[model samples]
Target: MTRPVRRTRRALQVAGAVGAALLALSACSSSSGSSGSGSSATSDSSKSSSPKVSGTVTVFAAASLKESFTSLGKEFEKQHPGTKATFNFGGSDTLAASITGGAPADVFAAASPKTMAIVTDKKDAATTPITFVRNQLEIATLPGNPDKVSSLKDLTKSGLKVVLCDKTVPCGAAAQKALDASHLRLTPVSYEQDVKSALTKVELKEADAAVVYRTDVKAAGDKVEGVEFPESAKAINDYPIALLKNAPNAAAAKAFIELVTSAEGQKVLSRAGFLKP
Candidate 1:
């Protein structure tokens, strides 16, 4: 071959090799860039999925949870500056019904598992309910024990104007169980809709005595007196809480549940006479 042709051939070969090397480098750089882009997208997606807990969270809770939950709601708002908590406190059954019936609520804190089951059974709970506390029945009497009531049997006395929660409510159900365990059939002058109503009966001196929760009696303080009974141990009510399936403020709802199950929340509950689960 001619020297010129040979030189040209070698130059062509060198140029081809360089071109291939450049193509390979370009491909590697493109692959690396794509990988980084994919990672960044995933990171952004994760951040969006877990948004900050900021918004209005509506909570439906049992009437008995009024005091402590109200306190917790305030603390939750304080922790998350841009958040607000609205509460609807009533009978667990009533609250469960409201939630299942499509009431706009973010959380539910029932006074009993049976009531919470109503929400879960309807697939309205975002997650499985957890028992946060336990409560037992107690006899609440007028301040100073003016009726001289000392025991559950005393509530059965012929002339005593005893009050009790409605049979459907957790407190009433517990009171019934205690009565059943003792083999005593005591008729109440009235069956209150919720624990607070039963407690109110005693607090207002409308009834001589009322079978209510120990927590209710303690909450009443100077307005009523509490008497512990043995049968109460057998009729403990488990209070369960959960986030709703279609929570309006999901992030805030989750944060609120975390707060209620946290150590700080337990302290408030204990101070209110609730037993930890």
Candidate 2:
């Protein structure tokens, strides 16, 4: 071949090699991009399916949460190996006070938003408090409802011994609102510090009846009878929960909160007689 012909053939060979190289690079890039996308999707799926959380999470919750929360704590521990859950249950206001007083708790679950407000107002909550459940008041009477207390007005019956939660607590506040709505005046034998205590009085026959939470009555089982009153609708308490600002186990606390708000958690609360928020 002549020199010109040989030069044209060499140019064509070089162009083909460059084109092959470019195509090879493009293929590699496409493969890399696809792999990265798949990896990211897998990572996200894994994260959502089995979140990684491990630590000791301390939760301060209302007295009514004692049973359901205790069960959730055990489930949390089981789901996250190397993690543990500890709970402090009491009156909502008292628990809020403890949290605001610098208690090293990871989470706070109150029976009423009013109680949770104390923490949020003090900037002790990591985020806005969210209502997880609601509760209504019920007249807890002796087994068989011996006194036949059917309504809030029945509690005002002459000479009937009754107990009530102190007005500061959520149950008490609800009870007072209910009574006020019914335009009824009830004179209780005594005022207990919490719903459980008030229910305990009736369970022990210390009083004929007590205005307490419906959940408390259910928890008391056959020991007490629950009398649903119409006025209770006007005084339902919204139970709020949140992670503390200074949580010692932030990750675990978040996980616990998620579990509590999950369908499974709601089921447990419903079984305990708590209404969903």
Candidate 3:
């Protein structure tokens, strides 16, 4: 199993992950749900007009989205009394691989369109993936800026012990884009498989800094300090979500997606530092 998958496998809930209930409703004829333009959710068939949702809604989301997604899941549960929202948070690439490998996920929310494409290209998605939110890269340093690191280039200094997400993942790819945009190079002590692991290294003081999503830095609170750079504009990652073609619980999955794209969901994501799509 991929490192991210293993981290949450033991706690995985059944019924796969969450997705668009509306898509399932329009399963036979619907072009409205095929194009993800502007991040607008397709018609909400899981609303009050629809029947109450039951069973579990499994959600496979990116690690950086953990905080906000978790909150939204709880709210989803509260809104639909007997339904449970189970999640498997990890690197977008790993999650995509798992889905394509037949992990039986109902919903997938990836950190980047590239990762989402992995599943879409395989026809694993029931409908076109919708870009829900965007995230920018930020430098995460120990609290109080102990290393006096103020810029992306500063991470290049000798002996800084900076850490980074593996280049195969979204955060790593964005960091690389920012680095290339600034014409700067950094040699991190190690490359983590997910944004959470990279941030954890700095939180534990095992590394001095890491390049991760702004949401991650904010979630860390006092554990780390966030430093924004001008080049991050060149590498913002768009998060996209979709219902799986083989969703075990299509009804609840659609309701979960509806909840994610709802106004309330946007508020939760905004507070977590995600950019408006």
Candidate 4:
């Protein structure tokens, strides 16, 4: 072969090798770009599934839900950084009244459907209230049931200092239904504004016994003992929760409600002695 011909062929081969290397590099760059775009798509999906939520979520919950709701609220704040879950624990009737009276609340969890209606009727609720759990009435007596108050009628025994929740409250209304179902009539020493208050009376030894929700008795944790009556079945109350119409933080409020109704939240409620709705 001539020198010039050999040199030309050698240069062409080198140039072809360099062009092949560049093509391979181009393919790798294109593949990496496509992979990055897919990763971006995945990130977008994740953000949609867990939309960013922040700010304070004010909740008005029934006194019976203090333990479970508070735990769920903490979980929510943990899941959503830069957020606060505040609660107002009180009688369902009182809470309903407040929600209807233009009180600023993100959520309202009532002890009964009737109390929820108090807000729904006035169009104060942004969403229809859903029952998350059901609560049954129980007679809370001194530790170890000192009074031996097992039956609803036992509260009627002479010299028994029993407390009942105010009739306007869900616990009180349930207690009344159970008492009426058993055809029993007993006068309570006091009518507390909420179930917790009535249970507190027994816990303080100020009252021998009180008619309250089973959850309250469980929350008391040996401070008071629970006595289940068959009549309680006749008076199970359904607890309902809803987002408020004028919630200052609607996005956060909705997210909080979703967490409460989620499986994790239900587990917490179940652990707290609440029944599934």
Q: In candidate 4, what residue range of length 10 has the lowest lDDT sum? A: 144-153
Candidate 2 least-lDDT 10 residues: 46-55
Provide the lDDT at 162 for model 2: 93
True-vs-predicted CA distance for residue 111, candidate 1, Å: 1.0
Question: lDDT of each prediction vs. the true structure?
Answer: 0.92, 0.91, 0.91, 0.93
Best by TM-score: 4
Tens digits of per-residue lDDT for model 1, 1-277:
6999999999999999999999999999999999999999999999899668888999999998998899999999999898899999999999899899999999999999999999999999989999999988899999889878888888888888999999999999998999999999988889988999989988888999999888888888899988999999999999999999999988889999999999999999999999989
- The candidate maximizing lDDT is 4
lDDT of 2 by residue, 185-252 (tens): 88788888778888888888899999888888888899988899888999999999999999999999
| Candidate 3 stretches greater than 4 Å from native | 1-49
Question: Which pairs in model 2 have colliding backbones?
Answer: none
Q: Give the poorly placed runs of model 1, Cα more than 4 Å off.
A: 1-50
TM-score (all chains, Cα) for each model = 0.82, 0.82, 0.82, 0.92
Model 1: ten consecutive residues of lowest lDDT: 46-55
RMSD to the true structure for each prediction, in A, is: 6.7, 5.3, 25.1, 2.2
- Look at candidate 4 and give me any clashing residue pairs: none
Candidate 1 local Cα displacement, residue 248, angstroms: 0.6
